[model samples]
Each structure stands twice: as structure tokens, then as C-alpha cells.
Target: MSSGTSVPSPGCALTRGRLAGVISDDAGRPPLDAARLAAADPDLLPGLHVEVLDAAPSTNALVAERAHEGAAEGLVLVAEHQTAGRGRLDRTWETPPRSALTFSVLLRPTAPTHSWPWLPLLTGYAVAKALRAAGAEAEVKWPNDVLLGQRKVSGILLERVETASGPAAVVGIGINVGMTADELPVPEAVSLAVAGVEVDRTDLLVDVLASLWEAYTTWQEGGDLAGMRLAESYAAACATLGSEVRVDLPSGEVLTGTATGIDPSGRLLVAHDGGRTAVSAGDVVHVRPV
Candidate 1:
């Protein structure tokens, strides 16, 4: 996580209906037509201003910039293609033209800035809830991966920005909906289409935003809450629970353990040889079944 500098990036914020005028570069991409999509459901997005771009350096980057420029909370930035899409730990995110749902949401958290660590997990829970509502089998991996039957379907990256008013998060979400195996950069990557299911991109986005709003509202009430709810939902949908797995720590240490569940603070509770280590962060890999 980079320390958020207070400099606003260069870009003007678009008002609500102003986003509908943007056009995609590709003529063949039908639903990539921002005007048509927004027109179909103007009321779907509540209290949120939206901006559509044909292509961008990165939606997350642009949203962070917009936030610095005083874009209101709930402002969404979407692009048909992103040249510099990314994920957690600076992993490359593939956002080919007209193939993926590449977007970012601006959120000014009521929670403390330190609590921003859990934003990715909360966003992951929202994605899982959205997919389940769309009739796709889904679960949230610890930290920030959304899975469909043991295969990754979507990933999230939450970036923080320092605005004059306060600190805010630009939650970047890339969901693979219509991509085929050949189109996916990672051989292990799977899409909703590859899972033998088709999902409407607009509907999925609506559900995801709604779920995120709900989670945000819950967190605003302030208890030892949010993380626990996310953990429980993640655990229930996650198939890795009770399995032996390898956890890759950021420090280059790999530990083997049996997955127990997540703790209240959103750490992975691994029953390792050391006896119940709470893993705050790691790349989890389920081992081959014996």
C-alpha cells in the first residue's frame, strides 16, 4: 500500500448524466456502449456520479485522481479498456477491450484510515454476494479474491487517496464475464462464461455496488463488526476451509497449515504446527489432495 499523497491528479469530474455521452473505440462492442447502458437504467445508480471513458491509463488511477479533485463519494469510473490495470501486490490485471468489467468506486470511509486494510476484503465480499445473486456459484478467498468452484473469477485492489476533506479509497474491481480461455492472460484464470454461465455485466455491477453500499453502511455503525460478517460470508462460500494448504507470506516465507477460518479482524486463522497462527496477509495455495 503506497502512502497516499495529497496531490490531486489532472482530470475534471463529470456530473451524473454526463457520463452517458462517452463512446467506446470499438464499433463491434455493443454493450460497451456507455450511452445505451446508462440510458437503460438511469435510476439504478443511486447518489453516485458516473464517468465513462473509451480507454484509460487505469480506472483506479483515474478514480483516485478524481477523488483528489473533490469527486463526491460513490463516484464511479468505468472504462472499456485499461492500459495499466492492476491488482493487489501490483499484479497485472488484464482488461482487454470490451471483454471485462473494469471499474473503480470512490469511497470516503467513516471508519478510521488505519482500518482501510480491510477494504479489499469488504469489496471481495460484495463481489461474492453480487455473483451469487446473478446465479453464479461464488465465494470470497481470504483477503481479496472471488472464486467460483475453486477457480478465480474476479480480483479486487483498493487504493487510498488523501483528499483535502479526508482520506478515501478507490476500490478497483475487474470481473471476467465474457472472456474466453484464449483471451485470459493467466492460464489458471476462469470467467463466468468459462464456468458455463453467462452474466449481464450491467446487472452484475448494480448488484456489486448495492452489496458494497450495504457493507459500508454496516461498517459505519461501528462495532467489532464488518470484518466478522465478511469473514463469515467468505468462510461459508470458500471451499478451502478445513484443507491443508500453503501460505506465501510477503517476507518470502511459506508456511503449511490446515485452514480453520477467519478471525474477527479479517485475518486467516490457520492451525499450523505452531498452533493457530492468525495470518494477517498471505497468498494461499491449496495443496494437492492426498
Candidate 2:
């Protein structure tokens, strides 16, 4: 894909009670423009198709259905408000209308299915890099959370689907953008506005999608973390590395240790008293060093 940039025109201001007629302090936020986004990075997503919704139950779910219907690889879905959005492990993710960037992109990779676990990690890296370029100083938390300091500003969820041709992946990305303190979903969450970084949402979306496309293409070419240098890049931007963490495994076991590194398969390696353990999946909480 060729590299180029396009700036979106200023959005039309919404009058009072214009946003779903549910008047609130944040009713004037502009909606995302599909054409403007396509124009911004025309070369990033070739044969790109986009859908911007005012609200949806879940962009990921919507895209998954489309993928099963043979949606092309470059299908992009964005929802201004996701009432029943989900994060990793089915955790509910909520944000005010147009207060965040909630979207999903469908991809059908030809790489081996074994290497699919890296898709989410690759996405987190792209988000962190894009946010940093936009002046947020963001970093990735182990697998798929984007953090500014200790608070989370974004999260990613990758869902696998079986298409007629092959297996497909839908990467859902949610970013807190213009939310105020009271509008934040949780105390541990923050938005770009709250973080004191003034940004245009459209620009942020373009940067993130472009970055993701670049990383995705690189991974598809090599089909391994080492080949794409994804492991090294993820380690460099991952805040979980070198930190004391408590991981809650799926089998109801908890392991506390110092996060040493990530292995070739993208599993988090934690060093404990007994030995180093590779955790393939879990809830990781950064803790004070014991």
C-alpha cells in the first residue's frame, strides 16, 4: 500500500438535543466520516469498504456476521456508540456516544492458524505506536491493552471466524477519546482529552488503521513473530515487561511473579520463585514488587 495523508474537513456542529435527543454535556461530539477516513489513507486499505453507524450493540459482532457472509478482507465497521460492546473475556465495554473510537476490521490471512495469536498483540503495538505519534505517549500492556501511565486508554479483542474460503479474524479496537472525567466508564480508565492530549478523532483513526495495516502485512509475509520483529517491538512498548504482576489463569489458579519477557509464540513469560512460567492467556494485574 502507498503512504499518503488526507485531512478531514471540520464536522458540522450538532445543535441541542440533536444526538439521539438524549441531551447531555457531551452531545456535540462529531461523528466519524467514512469518506474522510478513506481519503486520509487511500493507499492503506486498498479496495476498502467502510460502514459508520450511529450506534450498535457491538461492532465486533456485526463484523463477525459480515465475515461469515464472505465480507472482504478490508471491511471496516465503526460505531459511534456501542451499547453492549465487549472486551477480552466477555467483559462489558461502554463509552458515551461519539466519546470513543469503537471499530472493527475484518481480515482473512493466509498465514498458518498457529500464528494467529499474535494478531491481537500486533494490533496493540500498532495502537500504541499510533497514539504515541499523536502525542499521547501510550504503551501496550502485555497482550492487548493500551495504557497511559497505569490507566487504560484502549483495548483490543480479536475474534476468529470460519469463512467459506478460510479462517478470518476480526480485530476490535476501542479508544477513549473526548470523554470527560464523569463520562469515563471506570476510574482506572482515561481518554485522550483527560490525558491532556488534544487530538482529532479522525486523524487518530487514520493513523491507527494505517499502522495496523503496515504491521499486518509484515506479519502475513513472515508468519512468525521473529520474522516480523513483532516480538522485539512488542517487548519494547509493553509495560508488563520487568514489572511485578499477578496473573489469574483460566483454571482458577493465580501466579505472582516478575514479568520477564514474551516468548516466540507471544506467551507472557513470568519468573517466579519456582521457575519461569509461560502464561498463554490470563488476567494480568501489575502489582507492587514483593
Candidate 3:
């Protein structure tokens, strides 16, 4: 599922100016203190190595490369800005420097490859839970989009890479944090600050990572969503289920139906006039019934 989009030059004036401001604002922003994070939960992310980058083309790209080079699980990469951040369907995802939480984690799960589809779902549930814990009413859109009041505040991307040891999953997450109105990439995007949540970025990241780790461990224990109760939690926090929606399939066909449920494998189940269809991959949009 590798695709490319043309991005503005990385060294453009706008990028450099934004990076400069972000660097200057670091003095006042909350630092992602490794010691404090590890101490916050000794059981979570044990022996994890954290790297903070001032800028990168994409954290997922960097982490995927490292995973291939035998980078161990629990390696976390965070970047202040991503010039070529990617979202679902190879869409470009960009936010102003320091206005978002952009990071990737390398996970070498013991779960069977058949069950790997649940990774993004579990990650979405974890992110939604973390956001709610931070006082925002967050919910998940199908296939791992985190929304705060119908506006997307975060996104998750999972990539499978071949590591020296074996295959690994690189999970990339981006959360809008402090972007002002002028900085928002689109009208449907909102940030924590704009949503009226005053939170420390470091604290938010720690909470999210901890939640994700717990979810991952539980999945590994069972190798299935039902056994780990992940499906139940994900359903409870997902806003897409039980809604009239439109799905844009990869083959360029659009299906309009009511989102009935999510199957055990995490594919969306939609009921239309014809019958029921389980969609494994597509872009879903919630629609208002006329």
C-alpha cells in the first residue's frame, strides 16, 4: 500500500519559518521527559527507547527503516514536524511544527498474522480512551480515525515491515494539539486547544502510549479480539457504527448503507437494500438520511 504524493519542498521558507518558531517555543512547551514517562508507569513500555526528532519526512518511514535494521520493539520515534506525513489512501497529512503529536512505534507482536488487522482498531480505541481521560469527548470513526465531536483530531496508520528478526508492525499516530484556526489544515480538523482542552503534550503522549501498550499486550495474550475484549471496547467508543454512511471503495465504487457492526476481523459490516457487505478497506463518510 505504498504510494507517493508531491509535497512542497522541505526547505521552503514557510517550513523553515515554522520550524524556527517551534524551536523557540520549546522552552515553554512540555518536554517529553523519558525518565518521567517511564516512571509514570513502570509496567508500560518497559525498556523502551525514545527518540525525539526536530523534523522528519515521516516518522513512520524513519521507524520502518530502523525496524528493518533490527531496531527492537518498544522503540518510539517522535517528530516535531513531518514534511511528508501520510494518512489513509496515501493522502498527505501535514500540520504546523509543534502543533501536533506525531510519532511511530515499532511493535513485534506475537499474534498471528491473520489477527493483525486488529492493530489499528486497538490503537484507535486506545487513542480515544486517552483523549477522553484527558477530558475531551473523543470517539473513533471506523478504521481508526479519532474524532472529537465529529471533527477529526487524530489519525492512525499501521504498516507491516520485514525486520531482520522477523516481521513487525510500525504504528504511526498523529494528533492535533495546539493548532490555531489559521493553522488548521482543513475545516474538519480541530486541535485539543481549539476544543477547549488545556493539556500538556508530554502527559497526553504518555497516556496514549500506555493505553496502546496495554491494548497490545492484551491482544498478544489472546491473538483474537473477542478473547481480549478489544472488540467490545472499540465498539463502545466508535461513532461510525449504527450510522447511515457512504463507503468509497478502492475500485471506485461507492456504497451507501447503514453501518451495522464490525466483524471479529475488524472489517465494517454494512447493510444495504441488496444484502450485507463486509468492507475490509475503504473510505467511510457518515451521511445524513434525507
Candidate 4:
């Protein structure tokens, strides 16, 4: 569970559209190549450091530890296999070795601490936007789940921690890449391969990081969603908006309603018989077409 050593990594946040026409072959899962990634965007990633690990318990946990040790920002820790990979509410998902993308990026944003709740949605927009640009039918579900068509293809977890220097965020992202139908953990899950999008993992990673860094930079600007256009952009990219939804709350309560919009604090506004309830968090969110 170490942060691992810093390598001459290749992950440069390169062109955002590199995944648009990526070619996928049946040549088995190619290892994430540092050399190829390094050549992507050297100039743009001046201080960004990317580290690829063969196996780890969890990238999010490790990155958080590093931040506590006074680690700098822009450090990406990617794991090919996480024995203990987890999503929201302690839920777990598994992908065979090298079959998916699981990584975490550390950031110490300059935005107001109160507005940091938007970090998860900001990450969802980056992922969905990047994949959609690559021809996937991607849309963000509220908070930060990414769905291809009606099935989920990606999930994000943003953990906030107080470091010796300041508050930092560890953005953990997992995307299904090469799983087959039988390999899916659930029926509602799909992979890039299952969704008919063949892309190399490195290319996809670079593409996603580019989108994320861009969105993060803008949102960190005074944390103004409207001024940065993240509010409307995320609204357009979110599939939960205007859809009937069932939320399994952490308290074992069920809330069924139409998801109206995201409020300023990044809570989902659901209109139901109980009136419009602002859901701060949920254990599970099920979306049905209106």
C-alpha cells in the first residue's frame, strides 16, 4: 500500500480527442506503456507525474497517504489490479488484471473549501465528455457516475483530506475497458469493449486526464459553476436530470422521484410526493427513462 516510486512516466495530458478513432485489437491486453505515454504531451505536463503499478490495494488510499506526507499536486497513481477496489458506500467491482483502468490523481485546488463538493461532478463531466467525444454514448449520472447508453461504464470517487500544507483531493476513477458480458459484475455494467469502443488504455487515460485538468482548472476559478459554465454543461451531460429515479438512501429509506437539477452545493434535487428533496448522498441511484 505504498505510493510507489516516481518514474519517468509517459502520461502527458495530450490531445483530448486522441480516443476518437483509437484502434482496438485482439492482441491481448497491452501493458500501459510509459514511453508512449511520455510522448503524448510533454510540454503540457511540466510538473505532472504519472506512476503505473502492477498491483495495489487501492490507488485512492495510497494517494491520500502521500498527500499527508507533503506530496505535491499533479501526481497520478494507476493500478492495473486493485485487490480491494471500492466505489461509493463500500461497494466493490472487480476487473481482471490489465482489463480496465483504475487510477487516482492528487490535487490541491485553490477553490473555496465549501464548494469542493462539486469536485465529483467535475470529474464525471471530464470522463463522460472525453468518452462521448470518442463516439461512446456516454452521459454522467448525478454526482459522478458515467453511463454508456443505459449501463454504467465508469465510476469516480473523490476523497478529500487535510494535508500538512492544505486540503487536497484524491480523484479515483475506474473505467471498464475489456470486460465481456460474462465478466461484468452486474447486468447494469458495461465496458469500453462491450460498448463497441476499442481504445488503448494509455490513450484513453491521456485523453481523460486532459479533459479533467481542463475542467478542474476552470471550476477552481472561484468555484463558480455558472461563470465557468460547468453548471449548464454538467446539466446537459447528466442523464439523471429529468429522469425518474429511485435512490436507495444510506438510512435504508427509499426516495423515488424525478430528478430535477443539481443545486449549488452539488446536491440532486428530486421532485416527488414528499416535495422537492435535496439528496445529499445515496447508497445507490437507479435511473429510468421518463
* Candidate 4 lDDT, 79-108, residue by residue in tens: 777668888867886677778999999999
Residue pairs in candidate 3 whose N, alpha carbon or C atoms collide under 3 angstroms: none
Give me the runs in candidate 2 sitting further than 4 Å from their true place: 1-26, 223-228, 282-290
| Model 1: per-residue Cα lDDT at residue 225 | 58
Candidates in descending TM-score order: 2, 4, 3, 1
Worst 10 residues of 4 by lDDT: 14-23
Residue pairs in collision within model 4: 10-37, 10-38
Stretches off by above 4 angstroms in model 4 are 1-27, 43-46, 222-228, 282-290
Residue lDDT tens for model 3, 1-290: 11122223211101111221245454255544444543454555554655666667888998898888888888777777777999876878897767889989999988788888889999999999999999999999888989998899999989999877989999999999988878888998899999999888878887898899888888888654354478888888989899888887656678888988888888888899999998874344333221
Query: What are the models' TM-scores?
Result: 0.83, 0.87, 0.86, 0.87
Which residue pairs collide in model 2, if any?
none
- Candidate 1: global Cα-lDDT? 0.71
Report the C-alpha lDDT of model 2 over 1-290, residue by residue, as the tens digit.
11123323232111111112332335788766555664554566555465666667888998899898887887777777778999987899999888999989999988887777788999999999999999998998878899999899999989999888788999999999999999887888999999999988888887888899888889888654454488899999999899888887655678898999988778899899999988764444333234
Q: How well is each residue in 1-290 modelled by candidate 1, as lDDT tens digits?
A: 11111222222223222222444545354454343334433344456555656667678987888788888888877776777888877888875676778889999988765566667777888788888888888877767788887778898888878999988889999998888788878776889888887777766666677788777767766556555665677678666678787777666677778878877666777787788877765344333221
